[model samples]
Target: MRAHKITFAALAVIAGLSLTACQNDDDAAAKTDPSPVTTASPSSGDSGSDGSDPASPEASSGGKDTSAGTGSDKPGQAAKCRTDGLKITAIDNFIDGDPDGTVAVEMKNTSGRDCVIAGFAGVDLKTNAGTLSAERKGEPGDPYVLKSGKSIAFSVTYPLNETGGSGVRITGLVVTPPNETKSVTLPWPGKPSLPVTDGSGDPVRVGPIGSAGQGG
Candidate 1:
């Protein structure tokens, strides 16, 4: 009977030890294996809500500002038109060869006093390609002396070899009275003139009678 009691106590002690060891093991596992902490990802749309990135071009480039500098793409950026007292009264297109044509530019001294045009009046023909055909000197007359409010006319012609469109530019009227230079640019019909050079290092050739002067 005593031996049986001793065996029963020993089994009870062993069972208690096993329960305590299991409880200790459970506590150790709870401390070592904690719940994982979550992290944000770029694809998860988590950056916008936070104040990290301001989400602007300036912010992306280290807060450096970007703007159009001087002479930017804006209206009214072109140079304004400049005009002097000299005036061009008329530019007449006269007959040349058969079906082709020519142009004669008539300039008038519109100023009240007599103006001395020291240099030769020049005519530049601009082509469709924006290329200048040649510069011709106008038929220079005697030093034009005009009475106040009176006018005198000077003419220059450009000849066309073939039928098409060409642009005409008239310049080089150096008015000595006001000491100013004036020019006029217009589009007219004509073919390119034959290129030539002159003694003054300017081009000079007899074009269709009207298109005469220093060639470009």
Candidate 2:
């Protein structure tokens, strides 16, 4: 009976060891191969914002939308308006706010290529003895793109008694465009429309150069 009891205890110990080993095997398998997780993929056709490719007009040209008609010329590529390409002409006009004797002027772009003009045109009322400088008037505004055959306007205003009591007559005016060194002579009206300067060093009151046919 003692030998049988010892054999039964040994059998019980062996069965417990086998059961523990099976549990450890299962834990190891669970760690090595886990259940796969599902994830959504991105759309293969999506390029970027605005639903357009990288080579689109707004993207390729450095963020410029060419369809909006901004301009073809790039910044710093084209030169300023040249004296040779400009044709200055004089027109008589009387504006309420301006002085009594106002001479309207036009700067036509005769150049074959597009150019830029802005601010005021330097004016020197040409006299027989010497040239009298014109006092610039008005605030400087944005530059205008003067394309081929397009033009802009500016004016030179004079005092009511332009003769300065000397009865002097102005033959014409020597106009130098903004950023230009050379000056062009624009013939005055048949009579003395521009007043003779009193050597006050005050400008002849030149206006800003804006769109063509529009008095500036």
Candidate 3:
């Protein structure tokens, strides 16, 4: 019976040791192979309130736009007008009820294609003594588009020599279009108009080119 008791105690100790070894193995496994951690990824194709996409190709590059044309590739704009194919005329007494002495010069664009004209026409008064270039007056406005067969004109205004003052008598005029080197000559249209002085303050001045009717 004693031997039987001893054998039962030995069996219980062996079972307890087996249970301890199993618990140790489970702890080691938990330390070596842990649970995977979950993280959030950044959102794609997210366009902000400013209508720009942060992840787009344009944003990645630097937001430079090259879709529009450059240099001579301007769209919808005509070339500058040239004096070669133009027909020019000068008329005296073009405008009635004028206090200042005025001469109107008109230009017709005979060029087959459309072109543009801006600023003032170059005007020089021809006198018995010498030629005097008229000064440009007023700020230049936007360019005026002169379609084929269309016309534009400008005026030369000066204080009339009403008092028979000793002034230069203008006999003719030499006119050049803006941005053009060539010029045209026209005889001054009326009885010679005289200027008090062609000097700085009282100089003859040319107006900006505009509709043909304005010149008259």
lDDT of 2 by residue, 43-140 (tens): 67533322122222211112322122212245433346789998878887765665456777787778876565556788877766666687777686
Query: Candidate 1 regions off by >4 Å?
Result: 1-83, 96-100, 137-139, 163-180, 187-216
Question: In candidate 1, which residue pairs clash?
Answer: 135-216, 136-214, 137-213, 137-214, 203-215
lDDT of 3 by residue, 15-76 (tens): 75776785676677767767677799976753232222122222112221122111111344
Q: Predict model 3's lDDT versus the native.
A: 0.64
Every candidate's lDDT? 0.34, 0.60, 0.64
Two-way lDDT contest, 1 vs 2, winner: 2
Candidate 1's residue-wise lDDT over 49-142, tens digit each? Answer: 2112222232111221112111111342211111253454333444545343334433334444332332244445443333343343444232
Q: How should the candidates be ordered by lDDT, best one leading?
A: 3, 2, 1
State residue 116's C-alpha deviation in candidate 1, in Å.
2.2
**Judged by lDDT, which candidate is best?**
3
Which runs in model 2 stand beyond 4 Å of their true positions?
A: 1-76, 95-99, 162-166, 190-203, 211-216
> TM-score of each candidate?
0.35, 0.56, 0.59
Q: Please say which candidate is ahead in TM-score: 1 or 2.
A: 2
